[model samples]
Target: MPSVNPPRGMRDLLPADKARRERVLATIRERYRAHGFDEIETPVMEDYVRLHAGIGGDNEKLSFSVLKRGLDAEAIAAAADDPARLADLGLRYDLTVPLARFYASHRAELPTVFRSIQIAPVWRAERPQKGRYRQFVQCDIDIIGDPSARAEAELLAATLDAVDALGLEGAVVRINDRRLLDWMLGHFGFSADERPGVLITIDKLDKIGVDGVVAELRERGVTPTAVDAFDAFLHRPQTLELRAFGEGSIRKALPEDAPDDVVADLVALGDAVGRARGIPAPYFTLPVQFDPFLVRGMGYYTGTIFELAHPSVDYSLGGGGRYDGMIGRFLGQDVPAVGFSIGFERIVDLLDAEADAAAEAIVLVHDRDLPPADLVSLKAALVAQGTRVRLEQRTKNLKALLERAAADGYTSFATVTAGQTAADLEVKPLS
Candidate 1:
């Protein structure tokens, strides 16, 4: 027999998986819609150039390329040697890049400030682990062509709302500004050219601790003084008490002086949005510490960037940021865009573990009198009514069927009797 298992790093999404994923997706879509974001989609496979041009940091290495046959052998050999030419098309790594390309290509059709939601699968050649898969769905919402910091505020609010809709407790939205990180780096004597590598290492601070970051930076050729300066800068009073500083404190730290004004604007924006939307003030919290060390590895992010992490989970649940220059790279005009993506598989894993405690078993009725067409109709109707119904083949006896359903943890059974024209459904509570 041929190999029966799925390829490594991928698995089949059975019916139960579909149910949980759909529930999460529906909740996200409804929440985003209520926040004034329209629904949109982009192609699954895009030209390699369009996808690669603006991809942030390490993602370029993870893309899964699709190559066409019948090309010259020498050309094929060369393409294989050079990643840039290996394939003309690739599975999309994330939704934001496609949205950027969409805005640039259809600038006239979209509004000045377009708000949209996209739920789709993205591919990466990653080593799979718990809650991490090579093929997974990303739910994204973005606002394009809006340069105001209010756009960032709105995106953050929508994110908070969407996760709350997911019913996850103790979720934190960690926010940081890319410009702040840049400023901090410049202030500490690291040149602009050296920021990316150092920042990427620092961004891993949450995963690995301060020592891990320092060690990684040293390995990357950063001098001891620079590392010490970076560490000390991260622990400054202004950085530590970010939530307490209103505007005046921000001005004192940087020569630019405008950061305080932006922080003030963000504070006001958060308040105005809460009042207008009738959202409770407690849903958004400004923790005291703001790390200027947080530089999300994405190259396109230019403004506010955030990560939504569950306190119980060691990994990030979702993350996104503003990319003002991304669309301009393709269309010759600057378009501001911001978005967030929720990992569908991670959410499902969390929900399934919870749902198992309230396990319910579904019983399928298989009788000789029920025709195939009728059985199909009955199964569809029961499913539409929010029931999980299993199908029974005619060969199975009631005792055997019941035994199987019991093993599957189904507590209820529905079936047609010998003389019955319509089906009879029964709920049986299991001990």
Candidate 2:
């Protein structure tokens, strides 16, 4: 027989594992609910066209594709070399793209401004690193059809609360705007068409250092002057906090197309997020700050872009931004949207590191020959009194039973005595 093991990048969640995750998940859902985001669920598989509609960016290559069936099967087989043509459906890589398609398909039935909560597993066909996996859950909360900066402010504030709930200190969300980024690129001599590709390169700054980025940019044919100016900006020493960068020396270099009012907008956004009330009043330490070079990997972001990064690890705990033009791409009508997604797996890893693994459990050892009705009644009574119960058949060997319960994370045990009824139950601690 083959070994009973999960796939390379997946694993089973035991009972205690589930408890810890559920605890964190409950906190996140409560935060989302308090922010007025209603829950929504989309399918695991979406049409292959949805992945290629230009929203996924680098993620499209990582899609787990499903082959064609029914009507398209013949054409797919005829053109076997091109795998994309042979696939009609693919598993979703992220929730945002599918959400856009969902809204387009079911707009009439939804509210004018749809605030959605989608917590589900997404698949990718990429290399599995420390926190990256082939299958992982992503928690998304989006406010669609709202064009104001308040949407960004509220999303950041709510995410800060979620991060705080996860017990992460000094978790700050870095803020920037794609519009301002473009103006900066244009200021440094990049043409209209070069900005998008350049922004993608900029997004890789954290992964590849400035030298690596410059090398890649030069390989992509970026001019030397543009690269030099970008390098200078990256290496310049300055505090990333709002007050520091809000009045830094770099603030004086705004081009004609890039309005200087962006600073005012940043100040207002920071204030709005700071003022926005959370269930836990001060949800963040250094809440929202500025990262002039921060560009999220997704191509759909159009306006404000923000990311919440892990202090120890070089990955975002969560991130989201305005994708105003994405829905319009699907519906043929412009609809503004802003959203945020908490990286569920990353947070889970953080929690797991601190998890004790031996959370409280109670095991009920009943007689081997006990009637099923008696066991059921006893368990129900215990549960009704707000007790956690796990029933097992009582064997002659006391040591075996105790060892089994301990291995299963049970810290206490209970049993029925004397008469065969559940009412004559006794409880005792395992330790």
Task: Point to the candidate with the largest TM-score.
Answer: 2
What digit string (tens of lDDT, one per residue) describes model 2 on residues 251-354?
Answer: 64343345567666776676677666432323233466677788887888888888877677777888888999999988898899989999988887776434
Candidate 2 wrong stretches, greater than 4 Å: 1-3, 70-77, 235-258, 277-285, 352-361, 395-411, 420-426
lDDT of 1 by residue, 204-280 (tens): 88888877887888888866677778767545565444343234443454445345644665456556546545656
Model 1: CA > 4 A from native: 72-74, 223-225, 234-258, 269-291, 352-364, 369-411, 421-431
lDDT of candidates 1 onward, in order:
0.71, 0.78
Cα lDDT of candidate 2 equals 0.78
Q: Which numbered prediction scores highest in lDDT against the true structure?
A: 2
Worst 10 residues of 1 by lDDT: 282-291
